[model samples]
Target: MTKVVFITGASSGIGKAIAEYLVEKKYKVYGTSRNPDKVKDISFPLLALDVLNTESIKIAISTLIDREGRIDVLINNAGKGITGPIEDTPTEEMKSNFDTNFFGPIEVIKAVLPYMRKQKSGKIINVTSIAGYMGLPYRGIYSASKGALELITEAISMEVKSFGVDVVSVAPGDFSTNIAAGRYHTPVYENSAYKDSYAENLALMDEHVDHGEDPMVMAKAIHHIITSKKTKIHYKVGGFMEKFSVVLKRILPDRVYEKLLMNHYKL
Candidate 1:
């Protein structure tokens, strides 16, 4: 039987690349986004989904199950980036980021678990980020969101292991996607407290994202992890620099790691 995959955030970037790649590999793919109209012309079936809304997630999954009988894979690739100092980031924006990046995947997984449990086999691939492992200077909100996702992936992997379902988290370093251009920047302190510090950190983060790796590298990694017979809890995709950075993070003391990051950002 041809495997069926459901991917969110499929209108563009890594999600779009994954949909195209899987379709070519003969998998029946259903791609979802908040704006179905933007993806209507795409070759595969496109559905309307907003991860923050539980009802929308339930409706999407129900529709797919009614038509396809089983969902073989779920790729929680929908997310957004929020950049600014923690003190200068608005509370609502931070909450929104978590809703989209952390709770959103949890909601989708909950919705699909019943179908996958009955089928007795399925894979869930969550698109986390290197920020999940190590916090960055300006991406306080985004990093916290991804870190929560990483913890959830770990707990869910153990919970679903005996049920013959697998959950894997893919943590890619900065990638060349419109995410940088599209990142949400909330200046909570226009002329008030923490303005200077927030501006400096935001500028540093923007510089780093502008020179990130290609998104296709991450897409290929996702494909490999999904098709592998055994699931790994975590996978990282990036250039040598990213690998080296992770290595330093592992070996150095917390203070040392902080200093290195500060130096890299010229803070």
Candidate 2:
């Protein structure tokens, strides 16, 4: 039987790339866009789903299950980017980011687990970030949200293992995506304590995204994970240094690792 794969946030970026790739590989692919009606020129089904809404998540999953009868794999790719100093960024904005990146994925996972458990097999891939492994300056909230999801992936995997529903996370480094455009950025205040550094880092972050690796790299990595017989708890796809930074964090002392990040950001 052909595998049925569902992806969230599939209107563009990594989600769209994975959906398109899987479609070419002969999988039944259903992807979600917040405004599916507005998205044109698509080859696969793009359903309307807003990650922040639980009802929307339930509807989208049920809709896919209705058509396919089974959802073999789910790519939890829906997320929001938040950037700014931790102090300056509104608490509401931080909460909103967590809603999309952390809580939202959890809800989606919750909806899928029962079906997957009944089927006795499933794969889940949560799209995380390299920055999530370490708190980056200016990108702290974004890092924290994704980082929380990354850890959650591990715990969920263990719980779902006996049921045959495998869960994992893909932490991509700097992928060239429209994320920067959509990012919620706290204003650079004229008299804020971290004004100059925050402003400079904001520009640098955008530049990194612009020069980041292609999203197709992530697409291919995910495809491999889906086809594999056994899955790991976490898989990271990005440039060497980006992946290495995670290792550095593990080996380096706290202050040393902090210094490295500060130096890189020129803080």
Candidate 3:
């Protein structure tokens, strides 16, 4: 039997790459995005969906189920990054980040659980980030959202282990995508209270993103994880530096890790 996979945020970036890869591998794929029209002409089924809206999520899931008897994989990859100093970040923006990144995936999982549970086999892959493991300047809000996802994946993995459903998280480091182009940049004022502290670091971080890893690297990783006979709960994919960073975080103390990150970015 051919397996089916549903992916969110399939309009572009990692989601699009994964969808294309899966389709090439001969898996039936249903991808969702807010602007379905943008991807409707693609080779696969593109459904209109907004993870932040429960009704939209329900409708999209139903549409997929009506067409395909079962979904073998659900990729929760719809999310965005909101960067700025914590204090300067707008309260509404932070809430939006959580809505899309954290709750969005949860809602999708809830909607799909009954079907997956009945089947006794399914994989849930949540696209988190390296930020989930370590905090970085100007990324507090984004990190918070990804961190929540990590915990959710951990808890759900244990809860559904007996049912044969697997929950895993993919934490990729900075990948070359429109993420930086689409990033929500909160204005930083030189004369503001945080100016002296955040000004230089913010510029340095922005520069780093200007030259990040290629998005195809992350796409390949996603493909490997989903198609694997046995999948782990968490997979860290990136260049050598990203893998090294994860190792450093695990081995170093809190203060030591902080110093390393600061020095790496020349902050």
Number of the predicted model whose TM-score against the real structure is largest:
2
Clashes of 1: 0
Q: What local lDDT score does residue 128 receive in model 2, on the 0 to 100 scale? A: 93
- Give one digit per residue, the lDDT tens place, for model 3 in 152-172: 999999999898898999998
Q: Write model 1 residue lDDT over 1-267, tens digit each, in one string.
A: 999899999988788888988888789999998988855557788889999999999999999998999999999999999887777678998899999999999999999998889989999999998887788877877888998999999999999988889999988887767787768897647775767766777776666667888777777787788779976798888878887787889999999999998887667
Q: What's the TM-score of every candidate structure?
A: 0.94, 0.99, 0.94
Off by over 4 Å in 3: 196-203
Local error of candidate 3 at residue 161 (angstroms): 1.5
Q: In candidate 2, which residue ranges exceed 4 Å CA deviation?
A: none
RMSD of each: 1.7, 0.7, 1.7
Instruction: Give the clashing residue pairs of candidate 3, or none.
Output: none
Error of 3 at 5 (Å): 0.6
Model 1 TM-score on a 0 to 1 scale: 0.94
